[model samples]
Target: MENESVLIRYIKTKKGLLTVSGILATISTVVQFIPFYCIYKIIELLMLGNYSAEGLIHWSLVSMGSVLVGVVLLYASSMCSHVAAFDILYDIRMDLLQHLSKVSMGYFSQKSSGQLMKIIDQCVEKMESFIAHQIPDIVSALIFPLIYVGLMLMIDWRLGLVSLVPLFLAVAIYALLMGKTMKNNKVKQYHDALEAMNSNGVEYVRAMPAVKIFGLSVGNFKRFHQSIKDYRSLVMEWSNGFRSGYVLFTTLITSVVLFVMPFGAFLISQNPQDKTLSLTVMLFIILASGTTGPFMKLMYAASTFSNVNEGVKRVDEIFAEAPVKEQDNVTAFSGNRISFEEVSFSYIPGSPVLKKVSFELKPNTMNALVGPSGGGKSTIAQLLLRFYEPTEGTIKIGATDIRETTIDTLMQNVSFVFQDVTLFNDSIEENIRMGNRIASIEDIRRVAKMARCDEFIQELPNGYQTKIGEQGVFLSKGEAQRVSIARALLKNSPILVLDEATAYADAENEVYIQQAIGELVKGKTVLIIAHRLWTIQHVDQILVCDKGEIQATGTHEELLAGNPLYQKLWAINEETKEWEVK
Candidate 1:
């Protein structure tokens, strides 16, 4: 795929915006000469008017018309540029998201949410500037100065040519200054890193309780403040560099104008050989001097150009990433029969997590995945649903290898209830109905009752309509879990995966949730990743995963008698339960 972003490449592909953009840029470029033309016409009226009333009115109206036209063109130019910019940005965002779907799960695991946010923010901001203002502005800025210079040359070649001293000097200084500014690429890197840290820091700060529980929020305030200070100091350094560069460039430009331009004007005026009246020589000096608008701005706009380029590169990388697959073919699953063969995986190379692990799950069978930390039990469930591809093996759904099938095809018939549930800041019913958006109110109430959610949901101030707040903070942890289960039940997929959703729940609520799980799993192929021993006792088949391979796979009684690791884990969990009761 081309590295060019959708904003740049899309217009070429569509050619729809190209015409409008060209028309707008042309108008802006032509209107740039209005100021030069007006200056010449204004000076003529004033010089030849003879202090007449009608002459003053004539000049005033002409001056007013030029000013009005310039204003109108500038405004219209800005509007057209902005329109084109936003249109491109809209297309780019959609394309970016669509490409993101192809990116493998490993890519997601390797990136931080904060870093992702910065890429998104910077991309949109830079593309906006490029499309809305920079392209046309750069074009007009470059040509306007040349246009002014050409007009002056037509008036008097010697004076027009000499007036270029300031423009050349300014450009020289501007180029040198820009070189110095470009040396601060390190500053850009630091800024992006800081933005990522800030984004991650803010999210964690809001979830302070979780951090405190895990004893992880220790260096937040100090780290965040220091980062802020560092970012401020870095920006200040870049600003000073840019400021010195601009000032030096503009000063040299102004000096050339003051010293060289007027002297040339005098020389041209003193020419006794040709007497068309040297009036235009003076006009040439003023108009040619106006060329510095682009010259002086080069130093400033160059910084924005660099920053925008960096931003676009970051966004373009994401937009260019190969997605998982494009599956416009939304196929439905017939029935869920999960299978794994010669499955091998490693989050990091040379550190294998699952090696040659194989498993077969019969349709509508309840199986419990029992394992210690890092035992790859959760990895199995994640693979069964194609959250990731096996590094060296095959996982199949029905008769098709998951990779060969579209993600939507498998996912449409699978519902996942994770340990941590993050609900929206909307109504309870809305969150549950997210599974089946068009589900009727009666359907929502029916699923809630089945999942034991209606009893508490009805207790809320507005019942189904009550806002849950972010992550459903308005409800207790137990209630959130119930809402999650209700969602899965509403989804009513053929296969369901539960990741210890009952872990932090109280005894009564845990029992209630377990009952709801049993109901939901009645006719579905259920895969459970259990952290505790008691969870697997009711499962039809229990796989005791020690490291990567399943050491034992059988009923609870069979595993307890035959598998040593299974026995040890069972005894340990029983002791812990007894200790809890004591």
Candidate 2:
């Protein structure tokens, strides 16, 4: 019953095709039993001494033809199921991708790539076996039993009852194994172990370089090693626990002949009449024993229902996440000024990252936000991008509230160059084109020159067409920073946010990047979040932030003379610059 719910939930969209497949398979199963009936009739005729050579030959041909047709129908049924399964997989993947695209970036931060990949790839793939093969097997297993029982009863009621004894035992054993106390908990534990192992494995692989540098062995990687051990232990425990029940179930289902033969012989001994009828009944029982084979196959297929259930649950959980809301009627802003009015936010309740933060940046001016690492500088920038909404207060662009505008409109008017740069596996030109998809090759080249990306990009084998991989055509951190700057330059938005944009650049790259940033921020309302005090020494205004609050608002010299925290931070930066190897 639980397995039925899982199938129904996922197969909702593909129900029509699955229904057709089930119907065809059921028909095929019924046809498959035709030969068994034919054989029984041939034996009965021979026992009655009414069979001729031609009659025997005709019955043999009929049995052979039934088997052949049954095979063709089974093949056709499988083809339909495969088509439906693959189509369902495609739809599932597409739906997941679309949902993820709309979800908050915080979702990605909370989930590892490995975990998401396992759900999207492995979990979805696991459903293929259930949909393509198991569905048909289940249908045939269910329908075959009813037809088999009826045929057996027609021969002899005593033999029919004997045939069902093993089936009843198998069912009882299966029920005990799948009862609430064991099956649900054990299956849940197994899936949890698998997910943990997948996530830990990905984390370990990603940290391999650091591990090697630190002379770390697999045993030293505590979390990854522990996850692997836990998974192995859980699998072994489940196997050991379920082994006896599984063996008993298999033995009982297949040993139907054992009970049938003994009982048939007992009946014959008691009656001592109609010897031919007795022999025919025993022969029919032998042929009917094969019915348990389909039931055994059904049981094996049913075992995977737990995995399918887990996968569907995970997929549904992803779908349930709320995306950033956008107003249907979007308002247009007339200017580039930005403002935050009493804005506050927290990734978790009772742990505010930004507390009642309020600030405003005038149009076509440079402003800087200087603060410590956890002083909410990055959070402020992300809020403007609508990566998350303020739990309280309002953020606005020009004269209109940001919430009043569509996300697409908000993105179009703002550009960001953060410390972390992510470039796709595509060509350099293609990566730059992401900023403005319709930008021409000439526009791309111009921005590349302006952002100083052309300097190293031109040196590559294919220049702008060069492909990138994790290890392929490696770019220095500074060069990658310049490419990101080129993307921002091509975007040419009215508002620009630079969060440690030049953090990775060396002295030479820093000079080039600053020059490029100068061109990109021209006549734009810009907010710069920097740790290095020297970089923003000449900005139009500086807001000193500490503990999620603005401590002071002044120029570099003003802050140095006015705010002790700012003065101390500046002093530390100055001291670091003068220090050298002794």
Candidate 3:
């Protein structure tokens, strides 16, 4: 009941439809039993020598009519349940996505795409089966046996008690099966194996290009190979663990007649002249056999319930994650002067990425952060965008603390171009329009020309309408970077953060990208995580960071002469300038 509480909220939305389905299923169960009762009436009439053509026809027609009505009601019940199931599935998926959008990027960093995909796609889908088929089926399955068994008891106490014996044994064996499964943690193991397999399979597909180029075999990919092996082992173990109990339950359920028939025959043999006793025994035999099917169906529903319960629990876990909180009264910034005062952070608890670091970028100034690869330069940029919150201290824009402002306001003011450019599998125009949704086609083209990607875009088969990763219209790394810049330019935010915008560009592309950035930072507060020191030499301020701390702040020449660490980095950079491929 506790596990089902989480799912109940989602179910409540379509409770009316579910209720109708259940009611219809109940009626169908009662109507289905009428056929068996009508058969008994016809047999009694014949044995008592009270048969007539009209009576025989009436009973036979009643039996067939009952079956038809039952079928119609069952069909209507199924239709209602199916409609509710699909609508609920849609609502669950939409809610999941909405909740995910509120959580921090750090949550995504800790989870894989495959793991999330399994929860979003497969786990939520399991609820559809339970709602559509199992819900209605369970209603009928539970009611059918109760209705007939009660009727049997009203007719004769001895046969009714005897009929229940096999059912009780079947229920006991099923309970034992469930207990063994839970005790062994079968449900958890089953989901874990599936998540592992899905994760590995997605990785294998993504790495297929590299695999083919390197002539790699399945055996060489240990993670994927081991996932398959683990799944096989788990399936074998799960099947074997329940095999005996399942067989016993099935055998007991289907052989209900075997138990009741012998006792019924003994009663009839003891009272041979009593025609009523003989007819009662025959009726018990007919009804007891019918009860087995409902019990079988119930066992199936119970098994599906366990799996779906596990799946819904996994979905609930995603919803349980805390989202980034927002202030009730947000403070608007007065200016774009970005400041970080003693802002410390760590991706992991004890290993710090940025430690008591502080910096400032004055309004409309181009500032540069130059450091070694893992020296917290990029972390500083991410912190400004609130991809993560600092462990201590404050980041402010003018007189306003960043935490006091809404995320939408902060995002609208800042435009970021990542070191690794991301372009969707969409048209060139649509991809650039992501920055400013209301930007005109001319606006997009103007920025594209400024970023120097206009010529290649025009040369494509469909021009700006060409789709990426389709029709052989893929952009090179440098071309993609230019498109990314065009997007940021279109945004035209008051503050800009560039994390190595030209890191992967060729010399020609670098020249064009620099021209684009020259236009983008005209009236904005800019922060650049620079790799090539020469590019940012003339910026207003340069901060050299080392080992998660800002070691020095100065102009290019001042740092080169006064800081030993800066001098060493400069020497290394200069040496790399002369290196050439053999």
Candidate 4:
């Protein structure tokens, strides 16, 4: 595979099919010249004053038969190429998807959903056009001209040389149309504009609610509006630049006979009695027009190369990314105790979010991370779940480094519930089952009841079968949080991480969710990241975090009794509790 072209490597599985297609296309192109040759023979016979019904009929039938055979071969060639093209597209997309799954979560943070979608959908699809249509067209176009020009030269070298004048001019015009500037600057700009438009359009849709609440109009949404403007301007600029050059190329290619006719006429007059020479000039007149078809196809194929090449390079960029490294010799853990030994992390280099942070969760004990906003509580939970690796130092479960075990092995032991819940547009039962794929319907019901979502779920029109998201019933914030708990409960992992699980809950829902959480954490080591100090008052240990460092650790009573940051947080929490809307 080394030094192989991206396109050829992808299509190698169907190389034999493409080879067969190319052979058929070449034969079809050669057969297309039969009608021209037949017309020439008929004209030659007439000029020599040789008249016979059999001779005319024989050449006419051969011309018609060659055309029919050519049509059949061309059809076969197209079929083979199209089949190979679609299969290769499927393989490429699957490979991309599998690779994406193995990459770090950080990769997704940097890429927009729209950008990835364009690469997977539009960029990959671009290859289909090149492989299916252009490959065969290019092969036939290249062959047709060489054969046509060669036969003309054999008939009359003078007329053959004249026929090439328009072809040369047409090729020159085409070259200017597909110059380096058009390829590197214009085409790249067009794709960039398109990607920007797509990304902004997605952002605009996702923020539709905020826009409506703020009374914002499309014109006021500057990002989306500017994207549309730039896209329109680039398209106009591209089309205008291409329009004249394409017109000139087309005129030169199609009016090839005009280049041959005068020269042909002058040669005919040079020896009017030379019937062979006269017939040859007439032959060039009739066939020169037909030659335009292949040359025109060649121009079109060459023009498309820039766009397809650009898209292919974009696709290649995705394949060039490195996925998350996995352990070769996976180490087995001996217990449920989780420890972070002076672990430090940062999403970007040189800006530490967790500086020399260390903590231990004794097996089966409950712990809470209570901190102010931007104090790295959520980051600690994410680090434990291996959503990201520590920049320095080790995170171990029972004495084994988390990195020494496979991701699957690490994830199986730890369950995390995020502040933001993501539920698919699927049945409530299906959504919960994502936590445990092989869980039976009865097991799902048991966990749903434990998470306190079973009551509301049963009240829905279709109960557990009811779908969620846009096309179905939308759950309230608290109801969705309960459903997320139901998933964690089903997983029943040894350790759990709750990241502000009750942050969005109402008082009544919070009571029910707490009762559900009481059931979910039984016999499991737990870590709760909470902003509400009152919610974590009864935890076994409270770790006070501030400015990327663990400042203090104590029970609720001890922290409020001594630590200033803890006392201040508690005072603020108490004040907010007594506030009223009036």
Candidate 5:
């Protein structure tokens, strides 16, 4: 089966350990048959009217010893599997995380965090369970039957062949049933349903604030409710479909004596002289019937193979994505000027978001991009960050094409502070230190002061060490933005990109944020995207963009005097500022 192949390939790294486990499991399973053989011998002695207490006690001790040895071997086998399984899990998770770090940010836009979490957490755990527990079960399951059937045939070939007939029939029926289920693609459907539910559940929880504020009902949370309903329906359908086949399989496999007893009795009827031998063979057949229980357990464990295979395939899909290529011979840049030369890009093919956008920022100069909401201003910033490669043209930092250098090299020279500032649930000092890992206490404090965050940070109970969550303290948007600004200032990169950095600042914090920006951008090649027209009025240059094209590019006074679009925007900005509350 495809599932079997997936598991085999995945465990190739741990094949040595798994092989040892398998060998041990097979030995344990073979040892288990010793008690059955001892019982048969004792029964034979009784039938022959040679009852001896010492003989009985000896055989009983032998049987108990075999059982004890088998238990030890089985425990050793499980121990090996457990060690290998945990090691393999660690390797798998580490490899996945490393690959994700190298993958382009564009990959994240198409995949949800919930979906990735399910794959990384749940799917990997499934693989671990399969490797640790199910693998030993499968090994014993497979070897037990062969050894058991061989012993039966060695005793009496007729009853052995008869006993195997029901097993073969049960297997055929099982195959047919599984074939139908596979054809229905139930496994894939189940995986999809679970992923959807995970995604929707995460989304619903994240939207709880809005839900409560609007008094949203279950109907309002349609996507989450629908996913739950759909998952329930699929589970019910799968269980209902398997119900009949499962009953039939269990009955046929477990009832081996039903076939063997009849054939066995018929054989004994023909030979009265060898009555003791015939009766002993029948007892052996009855004892061997116990194997069906282990077989059923094996089948139950094996059924999960499909889910494991599906999980492996999903994990492999993530690993298969091409990472951002780094040039082997590339070196760092020496200048600070940034330029976009006729660059074009599209999130989706055929429909361009940035149409041959061209721009330049001189070193140590302020440049502003003024545009409508969807006018590609953010796309330009994203491209500069190399989150996604441009479909056409080139972007250069200083004299080097950005694609020619490694992402690490490019990122080391530039810093960005966007509108949506995300602060981790950690201490204030730690969050600021993320900008520059090697920054000392004094260095962090210097930037914090520059960003106007030191005053507020000092006011908190733990000062710089205060955690940023419900347990410690919470920050307003403006305060959070200042912290982010502190981070950017600490990095002290030559090139700076500010995407609506002051958008969330209150009127009071705006003055401090402006002063922070003044300190941060003093000697950097700055490219700022702003909606507040008044803020950029004194900038060195402003580019007015509309419909993914630059309509005009000049100083603010030049634009207001000659560009009609700019004039109208400026007028509206002025009007909004002067409007009084009723």
Candidate 6:
């Protein structure tokens, strides 16, 4: 409801377009009464006096002109309203996107890609229906109904009261049936759609290996089909409720109109001397059935607009998210030194994952954060990136706390390459150029060639212009990683966060990737989180983090000297990688 009010305020801001649409709407509604007035005047003149054919023709022409005016107004209103609606939707989506960008990385960890996408979809749908359909329909339909009811009362209050009984029943029934569904139906439908999208997205990732082992050329579509079937069942339930309710309401409106209309005509004729009862007013009674147009229009409007409620709820959920925090006295970067002083984090409160953890990395040095699985190694990089704020203590870039700096400023010095290698379904040049869109084509190509993607990119059918398919699906894991390295290299930030940047590489590819890393680490501060033993061997320092604390911190050789965990893990991996057996 707050979202609705905000949307209304936004729409009202476009005064010129809304005013035009309103004027058009008014013209359309006024003409609804004009036709009855025209028939009464034209017919009475013929019955009473000379009733010249030309005079009748003149009245008929006026009526035709009114009809034409109504048509023009309707068309204009439709066009202008649609324009405003689409523009509003576009602006709302942009606003939501901007808000999402401004919020901290903590928000993303708690939100799924599918859920956010669902929110976006709902925002668009709500704006479209409210701006495009609901507002205009309310004016057009409600005005006509009020005019009909008012005129009926003017003719005879007694008959008017009688005439509205079925409508009263219909309105009561509609409220009982449809109003009961207002809240839950929208929520149910929204979650159903979200579940379907999430399921499909997850299965798309998880079912890949099985697909390849079976030599399947295309992804199995059964999961997608099941999701659709589930959605269909929910929709059917929703539609059935409205469909049955509509039939009942329409029948009641019809029965009331039929009973009251004839009885009123009979009552009027009994007293033929009541000359104030004009023929025009009498025709209104005859056309009382047509008066149901407004009620029918309202019924139709409710049916269609129920779908928009789900959209509005989704939009509301997005808008409810709090904005990002702002630190008043932000500390700017001092140098490239990184440190964690008893810093720790957890996804949920109370059950802490990382306890009081601390470490420091010297400027322009390679530091490896290593441990067994479920250790807090990746979590350390996540903290440096400020994806999740530490639960306790502090993380500092240079000598300043990360919390003391703005996110953009903090990230200004950061270039993180994670396990996933996601590229847009775009050209190789454009994908790498995302590091900095304004970078020169020459620089982009230089970075690409440096990262070793230049060799394979040139071999592609479209060379640098080759489309990488969705998420770079056309490229193998190692190939995609090289492209990602090219992106980070082009970024040229002071701090680098590399998490398994060479995981997919073969021996030859690994050698090339390591050299790329060597060039990457020349002057920038680097933090490495890896499972591979080779990645940790020659780093300037190694911090083994587990369960949110630094279990050991020293040179790899020094850790093997003192820490049994580090020593045993190293022996296992080193033996696994030995060139020859004893």
User: All candidates' TM-scores?
Assistant: 0.87, 0.90, 0.90, 0.90, 0.90, 0.86
Clashes of 2: 0
Name model 5 segments beyond 4 Å from true. 1-10, 41-57, 261-275, 278-282, 425-427, 455-474, 508-512, 578-582
The deviation in Å at residue 32 for candidate 5 is 2.5
Off by over 4 Å in 1: 1-5, 13-15, 49-51, 180-207, 210-237, 253-257, 268-278, 296-301, 325-334, 459-473, 579-582
lDDT of 1: 0.74
Candidate 3 all-Cα RMSD:
3.0
Candidate 4 lDDT, 64-113, residue by residue in tens: 99999999999999999999999999999999999887777777788878
Those runs of model 4 whose alpha carbons end farther than 4 Å from true positions after fitting are: 1-5, 38-65, 182-184, 273-275, 455-473, 506-512
Clash number for every model?
3, 0, 0, 0, 0, 1
Task: Point out where model 3 deviates above 4 Å.
Answer: 1-5, 42-57, 271-275, 440-442, 458-474, 506-512
Task: For residues 1-582, write the lDDT of model 5, one tens digit per residue.
Answer: 334443465588899999999999989988988888788778877888888999988899999999999999999999999988998888889888999988888899888888899999999999999999889999898888877778778867777787888888887888887788789998889989999889888999989999999999666889989999999999999999999988999899888878877776777778867966576555757565786877886776767787787888898888788999889876788699888899999899988998988888888899999977899989889889988899999999888999998888888898999899999999999999989999999999999999999999999999999999868899999999999999999999999999999898889999989999999999899999999999998989999988888889999989989999899889889999988889
Per-candidate Cα lDDT values, in order, are 0.74, 0.85, 0.89, 0.88, 0.88, 0.77
Ranking by lDDT: 3, 4, 5, 2, 6, 1
Off by over 4 Å in 6: 1-6, 39-53, 155-163, 182-243, 254-257, 268-282, 300-310, 328-330, 470-473, 506-509, 575-582
lDDT tens digits by residue: candidate 3, 315-363 = 8888888877778776778999999999899999999988899888899
Number of the candidate with higher TM-score, 1 or 2:
2
Q: What TM-score does candidate 4 get on C-alpha atoms?
A: 0.90
Which lDDT value does model 4 have at 531? 90
Q: Which regions of candidate 2 deviate over 4 angstroms?
A: 1-10, 38-61, 106-110, 180-184, 268-279, 440-442, 458-463, 470-472
lDDT by residue (tens digit), candidate 6, 1-582: 454644665677676786788778877988867766777777788667769888899888888988888889888887888888888888888888988877667787667666677667754766677767666776788777677678778867777777777788888888777676765665466466655666566655667787678776333567666676667777787668668777888798777657666776676688766544546345655556665767777776775566555565566666677766657765689999998888768877887778888778999998988888887787778878877777788888888888887887887799988788888889988989988878998998898878877888889988888888854439878888888889998988999999988888888788778877777777988898877866778889988877767888899889989998888888888887867766
Higher lDDT: candidate 3 or 4? 3
Clashes of 4: 0
